[model samples]
Target: MYKQLLITGGAGFIGSNFVAHWLAQHPHTQVTILDLLTYAGNMANLQSVADNPNLSFVRGDIGDKALVSSLFAEKDFDCVVHFAAESHVDRSIEEPDIFLKTNVLGTHNLLECAKQHWLYPGAKPRTHLFHHVSTDEVFGSLQPGESPFTEENNYKPNSPYSASKAASDHLVRAYHNTYQLNTSICHCCNAFGPHQHTEKLIPKTIHAILSNKTIPVYGDGLQIRDWMYVHHTVEAIERIITKGEKGEAYNVGYNQEKTNMTLIGETCSLMDKLFADNTQLQRQFPEATKAAEGKSKELISHVEDRLGHDRRYAINANKLSAHLNFSQTGSFEENLLDTIRWFIQQHTKVSTIDI
Candidate 1:
């Protein structure tokens, strides 16, 4: 088990969930979270475990070489789970420079610092693990009948966000090969759960309905994505760090594929069910009362497609399953309802507090 660990981007949705999950599973392990607190990174995400005796938080950017080096020297982390990067495609399109600087240069800085600290002269390999959390977007789009992305898939990133992540993935592989650093990479599919920022598709659709705003669907809403609960991805992370081989990359997914339009329809149906009885929703979100009457679907509106938008992304999790003996848990409907319920609870709580 890793004694001292460093988790980058720990304030973001997936990272924050991983911290809480890790602490719960291993009460003795100490975790230090370093995050830049970007727009998507919220401190409130970590509030559940804010006072955890085994967890600590630090506000910093990974692109800062000096600060990162200082942290590595001071903490001497036995393991690093890096989730820090400019992740949103839309945001990356709006600003590509920051993505390159943070995802590419920032990753390079962490690799160098880790090399100096964990791979010093006479240092033992495999004594420490550097696990990188990446995305399936790096594989670009797939055809309707094309096979899912695997570890051996060629790099064909379409957007700046994916390009940056692809660069980082290559750098990690290079370090492992050239410098003999013990590293592992997991390229995951769409991860959804609580604490996700409202900008994402799932949360965006829910929030739009609640606020009575139009639900924008890019292009034909035919873009396909494989969705997995955040918990499953984190479990894959834990397994990869503890048992995966050095320099090998694994694809993390649950084989739950759905079109954007289909997902939205499902969400609307659930909202209708939840609001059928009582005014728990109408009292808090009057505009969304239409959901109770099954009219929320009226808000859906098609819009111009994003530039260079990939048509599909799916992952072949055989490597992760075969190696780690792990399989995703839960049906899509169950997970989707759980996610919807969480959003409802959060919105209800906030609305009540504001009243």
Candidate 2:
């Protein structure tokens, strides 16, 4: 239980969710968030917890070494949960330098600051931690029958995004081995939940359906991803931070693999049910009456595939499960419904105000 913690990227999807979760579960912990407020980072996501006495929001870049060092010196953070990075693969493909800067150099900056603050000459490693949140794409795409990614899998990142993440992962391991920085890394599969940016697949699909627009599917939309809800992802991270061995990496997943098309279909089915019965939409967005018509399936639009898109990504979580005794409690469908409801409620609120 870290009393004073720094959470980088706390305004983004997973980061913001983790902040809310942490404050709720550990009310005594003080959290300071460092975010650049990039397009993906939205302050609206943290509205529910804006008044949290244990939370402080700072708008800054992790690459700013001076700022990070100052924060570490002032707050004396015992732990750092790094979630700040340029995460979108398509954006990375267009401009890879930002990804390298934020994902690699930004991570390096934080590691250096943490090392200076937490490490001292001729001292055993302290209880302080630097927890790195990463993605399974660092293992590259898995074939149909190939085994899921384990911690031992060779680094074969397929995109600028994944490669940048791979570099950061290596840096974390290097710091642990060479400098003994007392770090732990967890690589998760695709995450879906509330407050996710709409540019992402699940949220974008939901947005298209609700707005009577075409829902674009890249290629055949059969790309497989192990879907972990944001809450479960946070739980896994907490477990790793609390009990995981130093210098080790864990693959965090629930073994729930769903293809792009299947996920879209499930989301559309749920939306149809919600739109038909939602009183908020009837009162606020009568224009959304067509959503209840169940034509969301007709909105499916197959577009060009993502460049160098990985066909499948799965994680072998036997290690995480056996070692930590952790298990995911909710089914994908249950969580997906919960996520869809949140988005609808959010959209309805916005639409109501617009009218």
> What's the TM-score of every candidate structure?
0.96, 0.95
Query: Roughly what TM-score does model 1 have, to 2 decimal places?
Result: 0.96
lDDT of 1 by residue, 238-341 (tens): 88988899899999998989999999999888877777754666677777756867788989999999999999999999989998898766788888888887
What C-alpha lDDT do the candidate models reach, one value each?
A: 0.90, 0.90
Q: Identify the leading candidate in terms of TM-score.
A: 1
The C-alpha RMSD in Å for every predicted model, in order, reads 2.0, 2.3
TM-score of 2: 0.95
The per-residue C-alpha lDDT of model 2 at residue 281 equals 58
**Clashes by residue pair, model 2:** none
The number of residue pairs in model 2 that clash at the backbone is: 0
C-alpha positional error of residue 236 in candidate 2 after TM-score superposition, expressed in Å? 0.8
Q: Model 1, poorest ten-residue lDDT window?
A: 346-355
Q: What is the alpha-carbon lDDT for the whole of candidate 1?
A: 0.90
Question: Model 2: per-residue lDDT, tens digit, 253-329?
Answer: 88988899999999888877776666655556455555768667888999999999999999999989999999888
